[model samples]
Target: MNRILIVDDEAEIRESLEEILSEEGYAVSSTSSGTEAIVLLRDAPYDLLLLDIWLPDRDGLDVLADLASLETDDKPEVIIISGHATIETAVKATKLGAFDFLEKPLSLERTLIVVKNALEARRLRSENLEFKRQLTLETTITGESVPAKALRQQIKLMAPTNGRVLIYGESGTGKELIARAIHSESPRHDRVFIELNCAAIPEDFIESELFGYRNSAITGGPAEKRGTFERANGGTLFLDEVGDMSLKTQAKVLRALDEQSFVPVGAAHPISVDVRVIAATNKNLEEEIAKGNFREDLFYRLNVIPFFVPPLRDRKEDIPSLAREFLRIFGREYGRPRVEIAEDALDLLKQYPWPGNVRELKNILERVLILNPHVHRIERKHLPRLVYRTTGRRSDDFSTLQQAREAYERDYILRKIDECHGNISRAAESLGLERSHLYRKMKTLGISIRESVS
Candidate 1:
C-alpha cells in the first residue's frame, strides 16, 4: 500500500485527513508540527506528504526547502494545503518542489485526485531511478583490458555521429550494454533510450510498436499513439537481435532510415525524427543475408558503424576482474556482506568456456552466493561441476572421465532447454547442434523428457 503523511496543526484537520486517506486504502500518518513531520519523514518512508503552510513550529516552506536538499531517491512529493496562504506562497511552494497546492477548504474529491497524481508522479520517479540504477550496474561496460578500452574509445567516437551502429557479438556478450553505453555517452543522452529485441517481439505487432497506430474509429477514435520511434526522438533507439527482425519489418526500417521519417499506422502525415539507431545481433549479418533471413539494404543501413564485442574466450584476461565484479554484485544481491573468490575458483572460472558470456557468469555467481551465503571466499569445490568437465580437464580413469563428460553435456543441454522453455529447436540452435543430435544426446544421457522436465 502507498504511504502518505498528513501534516496540520489543527487536530480536527489532521484526524479528518487521516480518516479520509485511510478510508481510501492509503497508509496514512499525521503530525501537528513541521518539526515532528520532518523527524517522522526521516525515520520512515512515505510516498506523498500533505503539508499545511500555517504551522505552529517551523514553516512548511522550510520543510520543502530541506526536502530539496536531500537525494532524489528518498524524497517524497509535497502537496501544500493552506487556508491562510497567498497565491505567491503557493507558487513558491510549487517552485520549491510542491506537487500541488490545495486551499483551506479541501474537497475530498479534489484532494484525492491531487493525491493520486502526486503518488503517480512519485511512482514514476521511483521507477526512473530504478531504471537508471539498473542501467549503471548492468549496462556500463566493465573492463580495463585492451579490447574493452578499444570498445569504449569506439563508443566515444561513433556516439557523437548520427550514423547507425551495428553491434556484433555472441549471446550474453553484453551487446545491449554497448548499445546503452554509446547512447548514454552521446550528445542525446538526456533523451530516452528505447530498446526492442527483434527476436522476442512477435512479427505481427512489430509495425504497430515501431510505428504506433492512429487510434481510429475502425481500429479502436483518432487519438495519436507514439511508437518507439517517436518515443526515442532526439535520442537513441536500440534494435536488439536485428538479424532476427522479419524481412517485412526490416524493409520498413530501411525505408525509415532512408527517409528519416515514418507515418504511424493509419496516419496520413509522416512524422520526422532525429533518432540515432543502434542495432545489435548475435548472429553474423553476412550469413543472415546469405540465408535471406535478413535484409541486405537494412543491413547496410544499420552497419554504417560496426562494433564487434569480443566473446569471453577472446577476453580471457579480463576473467579475474569480471569474476570479482560479479562476486561483489551477487554478494550484495544475495544479502551477503562481502564475498571473494579463491585463487583456485578463479582459475577454474578462467578455464571454462563461457559460451553464455557475461550474463551466464553473473547468473552462476548469483547461484553460488545464494547457496554459500555470507561466506568470505568461494573455492574450487564451490564451483559447478560442468566448469571442470567441459574445460577438458578430467581425471585419469576413462570411465570416470566419460561419466563426467556426459554429466557436463547433460547439464549444459538442460540449461539451454530451460532457457528456451523446453523448446527443442531453440535449445538446439543455442547449443550449435542439430535438433536430431540434441534429441539423440538427450536419450543417450538418459534424460527422460517427462521425468527430466517434471
Candidate 2:
C-alpha cells in the first residue's frame, strides 16, 4: 500500500490532507507538530511527506534539518507548506533538500495530482531496485589482468563501508561497470543503483532534477515530480559525469553530503534520504578545482573511496583477451558460422594506439566482421583508413617551384571547400579563390563542389 505522512501545526490542514489522501487509497498519517511528526516518521516507513513550514514548537525547516541528520533509510519524501514564505526560504529549503514547497492557498486538484505522482515515482524506483538486485547475481567482472584483479579486491574491501566512492576514467574506460561491481559486492547490493548523468542534464535544472521539486508542476505538465535522489532511498546513487555539474548545484550537493538531507525545488518540507553515493567523471577533477568549478568539500566527501580505471594504453597486455571477447560477441551477432582473428591483424591491433579506447576496439571489430564477408580471419587490409600507414610518397610530381606551389594551393583550396558550411561562395571567399576557380580545382581534385562543401 502507498503510505503518506502529513505534518502541519494546523489541525484542519492535517485533517484535510489525510482525508483526501486516504480517500485516494493511501495509508495516511497526520501530526499537528513537527516534533511529534518526526517521532511518528521515525517509527514507520512512509512513501511521501506533506510538511508545513510553521509550527508552535519548532520551525518546519528546523525539523527538516533535524530529519536530515538522522541515519536511516525510511526518510520521507517531504513537501513543504507555507503561508507566506519568501523565495529565499523556498530556495534554501530546496537547497537543504526539500522535495518542493506549497503556498498557503493550496489547490485540491494540485495536491491530489502531486500526491499520486510522488507515489508512482516511488513505485517505479522500487521496481528498478528489484531489477538491480537481479542484475547483481547475473553479471561478473570479465578481465583477468592484474589491474582488474586489484580493482576487484579493492571493491571487496570497500563495499561494506559507508564511504563515498569517486571513479575516474576516460570515456568507454568502464567507470560505470566498476561502480556497479562495487555496488553489487557491497552491503546495499540488493537495493537500487540509481544513476544521474550530470553532463546530460541541462545546467538550469540540475538541482531540481537531483534533489526533486515540491509543489511545482513537471515541465509542460500540471502534476509535480520526484527527483532521482528520493528515488534511490535505501540504495546507491551513482552520479556519472559529476564533474560537469554546475558550481551552483555543486554547492547544494556539498551541503546535502554534509547534512544528509535536502529539499526539492519549490518545496516546503525537507526530504531525508539514506544513500551511498558513487560519482564518476572523465575530466580531471583536480584541474576542475583549479579552475574554481568544483566544491572542495564535496571532493573530499566523494574521494573517500577513489578508484581509477586504467586506460587500455596502460594495460596493453589485456588487449588480446579483450579482443577475443569482442570477436566472440560479434561472431554470435553476425551468425556467420564462426570468425577468427589472423595473427598479423591481431599484431597490428596491439601496435595501434587506441585513443578512443574500448569503444573504438568494439567498433573496429564490428566493422571488420561486417565487411569481411565469408572470410574466417580478419586481416589488416579490411581495417579502416585511420589504422594504416603507407611506406612511400612522391607519386605525383610537380614540374617546377611554381607548379609545386600551385599544387599546394589546389590542395588547400579543396580542403577549405570541404570544411565550409555548405556554401560555395563562402568556401570561395574563405580560400581566397573565385567560385569558378574553386569549382574547377574541385573538379581536378575529383571532388564535387557541393559534396565537398556539404
Candidate 3:
C-alpha cells in the first residue's frame, strides 16, 4: 500500500485527511507539528508527503528544504497545501521539487487523483534510478593498464565539455560502452542518450531516421515523428559506424551539427535542438576521406575531441582483470558461483590476439561460463580452440579428442546462431537439425540456450 504523511497544525484538518486516506487503503500518518513530521520522515519511507504551509513551531517549507539533503531513494514526493497560498509560494515549492500544490480546503477527489499520479511517478523514478545504478556498475571501465588509465582520464576531462567527440576504434572495442560512459559522466546525464548506427540502416532511410518525417513524407511515413535530434535535445546523440554514412547524408548531418537545426522530410520549417554529437568509426576516417567515401568537412566537424580506443591485444596485461570481471558478471547472471580461471587459461587469454577486441572477449567468456556452469575452474583443457590459436602454440593444448570435438561443436553452433541473429529455429533449420534437438545439443554443449537467443 502507498504510504502518506500529513503535516498540518489544525487538528480537524489532520483527522479528516487521515480518515479519508485510510479509507482509500493508504497507510496514513498525521502530525500537527513540522518538527514531528520531520522525525517521522527520517524514521520511515513514504511514497507521498502532504505539508501545510502554516505551522506553529516551524514553517512547512523547512520540510521541503530538508528533502534535498536526504538520499535520492529516501526522498518522497511532496505536495504543499495552503489555505492562502500565493503564486510565489507555489513557484518556490515547484523549484524545490514539489510534485504538486493544493489550496487550503482540499478537494478529496483532487487529492486522491494527485496522490495516485504522484505515487506512480515516484515508482517510475525509483525504477529508473535502479536501472541507472546497474548500468553504471556494469559499464565501469575495468582495466588497470596504462592505456586504460589514460583513456579514463581523457573521458573524465572531456565528458564535462560540450565539444563534439569522434571515437576511433576497431570493431568490438567497446566504442558504444565508452560513448555511454562519457554521456553518463557528463552534465546532461539526466537527459536522453540516443544512438544511431550508420551501417545498420539503409542509405535511403537513414536521413528520415535521423531527422524524422511529417505525415506522408515518404511512401510510408508516419503522421508525425520526433527525430533523434529533437528527442536528444539537451542530451547526447551517438552515431556508430559513422564511416559508413552516405556522402549525401554526411552533408546533411554536417549542416545539422553546424547549425543545431534540421528540416523534417516533409516539413519546410527547420527545428532547432541542443544535442551533443558523439560519432564513432572503426575505419580510418582520414583514409576514407582520401578515397572520397567520407566528407572532409564532416570529419573536421566531428573530430573536435578525438578519442582512440585501444584494441584488446594492445592491452594484453589487462586481460586477467577483464576476464575475471566478465566471469563474475556471467556467473551471477547464470546463477553460479564465481568461476575460477587456471593460470594456464589466464596465460592463454593474455597471449591471444583478440581480433574482435573486448566485445569478442566478453562473448567468449560468457559462452565459456554458460557452458561450464558446473565446472568451478577453467583450465587449458576447458579452453576452446578459438582461444588456443592465440597462444602461438600448437593445437596440442587439449589432451583429449572429446575436448577438441566439444570445442569445434561449440564454435560451429555459435557461428550458426550469429548467422541467424539469435534465432534458434532458423539456426537449427540451416544446420539440418530439429529445433528441439538443437536446444538439447546446446544445453549438452554448455552453450546457454537462453543467452544465445538474445
Candidate 4:
C-alpha cells in the first residue's frame, strides 16, 4: 500500500485527511507538529507527505529545509498546505522540493489526484534507484587474491578523480569489469555509463558509433543519433579494446578528450560534453604505438591512470572462492540452489591453467550446472574432461623432485577419493593406509573437505 504522512496543526483537518486517504486505500499517519512529522519520517518510509504551512511547533518551510538536508533516498514527496496561499509561498515551497501546493479550502478531487500522482512518481524513483543498485552489483570485482585486492584499492583511490583511465589485461581477464568498477565508484557514478567496443564495430561504423551522426549520415540511418560520447555526458564512457581503433578514429578520440566536445557526422556545430573516458585493451599499447598502430598522443591522454587485471592462472589460489561464487550465482539462476562442489572437483579446477581467465571459469561452471540439472552436488567426474586430462604438468614444469612427487600424490589421492565417492575409509583401504594416516596425508597436501559424501 502507498504510505502517506499528514502533518497538519488542525486536529479536524488531520482527522479528515486520514479518513479520506484511508478510504482511498492508503496507509496514512497524521502528526500535528512539524517536529513530530520529521521524527515519523526518520523512523519509517512514506511515499507522500501532506505538510501544512501553519504548524504550531515549527514553520513548514523550515521542515521542508530539514527534509532536503536529510541524507536519505527514501524521502517522501511533499504537498504543501496553507490557509493563506500566496504565489510567493507556493514558489518557495516548490523550491524547497514540494511536489505541489494545496489551498485552505482543499479540493477533495484535486487533492486525491495530486496524491496519486506523487505516489506514482515515488514508485518510479524507487525503481530507478533499484536498477542502478543492480548495475553496481554486476560490476563488483570478486576474489581475495593480491591482484584483486590491489585493483579494488586502486579503483577507490582513482575513481573519485576525473582523470582518464586505461586498463591493461589479457583477453577475457575482466578489463571491462575493471572499467565498470572505476565508473561505479567515481563521482559520476549516478550518471550514465556508456560502453563501446572498438574491435567489435566495423571500421566504417566505428566513427559514427563514437560520435553520432545527424541528418541521416549513413544512407538510411536515423535522422539524428546520439553517440556514446553524447550519451555519456556528465558520466563515463568505456572504450573496450581501444588498441583496435584505427589511427583516424584515434585522432578524433584524442581531440574529443582534449576539448570535451565533438562534431557529429553531417552536423555543423560541435556538441560540448563533460565525459570521463575509460579505455581498456588486451594488447600492449606501448607495442602498438611502437608499431605505429596506436597514436602516442591518445595513449598519453588515456594513460593518466593505468590498471592491470591479473589472469586467473597467476592467482590460482583464488579459484576455489571464484568457483563457488559462480556456482552459487548460476545455481540460483538455473533453479538449482544449494549447489555444492566436491573438494576433488575444486582440486581439478586449481590444477588447470585458465588461459581464458575468470570468464572461462564462469562459463564452465554455468555449463556444468546446465548439463547436470538434476545433480545437486558437483563431483570431479562432472567437470569437463579437459579440466583434468590436459591439466597435468610436464616433468620439466616442476623444478624439484619433491614438488613433482607432492603433485603426483595430491592428484592420486584426489582420484582415489573421487573413485570412492569421497569415502575416506575406502580410499585409505585402497591405498593400504589407515584412515587416520590418510587424513594426515590429506591435511599435509592441503586438501580441504568441502562436501560430505558416503
Off by over 4 Å in 3: 1-132, 217-221, 390-454
Query: Mind giving the per-residue lDDT tens digits that candidate 1 earns over 163-239?
Result: 88999999988898899888888888888999988888899879988998885455444466688998888899999
Number of the top-ranking candidate, with TM-score as the measure: 4
Per-residue accuracy of model 4 over 1-454 as CA lDDT, tens digit each:
9899999989998888999999999999999989988888888988899999988899999999999888898799999988997888888889988998888888899999999888888899899998986786688888889998898899999999998899999988888888888888888988998999999999998878989988884566569989999999999999999999999999999999999999998899999999999999999999999999999999999999899888887887788888898898888777788999999788778777788889999999998898778888888757764464334466654567876777677678878888898888999999999999998987776555543242
- lDDT leaderboard ranking: 4, 3, 1, 2
Candidate 4: where are CA atoms >4 Å away? Answer: 1-133, 217-219, 391-454
- Weakest 10 consecutive residues, lDDT, candidate 2? 388-397
| lDDT top scorer | 4
Question: Can you give the TM-score per candidate against the true fold?
Answer: 0.58, 0.54, 0.61, 0.62
TM-score-best of 2 and 3:
3
* CA displacement after TM-score superposition, residue 60 of candidate 3 (Å): 30
- Assess candidate 3 and give its TM-score to the true structure: 0.61
Q: Quick one: RMSD of model 4?
A: 8.7
The sequence of per-residue lDDT tens digits that candidate 3 reaches over residues 319-375 is: 888888898888888887668898867875875678888988999989877766688
Candidate 2, backbone clash total: 19
| Model 2 lDDT, residue 138, Cα | 37
For candidate 1, list the clashing residue pairs, or say none. 215-222
Model 2 stretches astray by more than 4 angstroms: 1-139, 217-220, 336-338, 389-454
Ranking the candidates on TM-score from highest down gives 4, 3, 1, 2
For every candidate in turn, the CA RMSD to the true structure comes to: 11.2, 23.6, 10.4, 8.7
Name the TM-score of candidate 4: 0.62
What digit string (tens of lDDT, one per residue) describes model 2 on residues 1-454? 8788888888888888888888889898888888987887777788888888888888888888888887874466778889999998898788767777677788899888777776776677767776765585334555677987788788889988888999998898778887888788888988999999999999888887898776775577645668888888889999999999888999998888788898888888888989889999998998999889887888898899899888866666667777777777778768864677777566546655677777788788887778667778766545553333211213233346664554455456645655675577888898787889877866553344433443
Decide which is better by lDDT, 1 or 3: 3
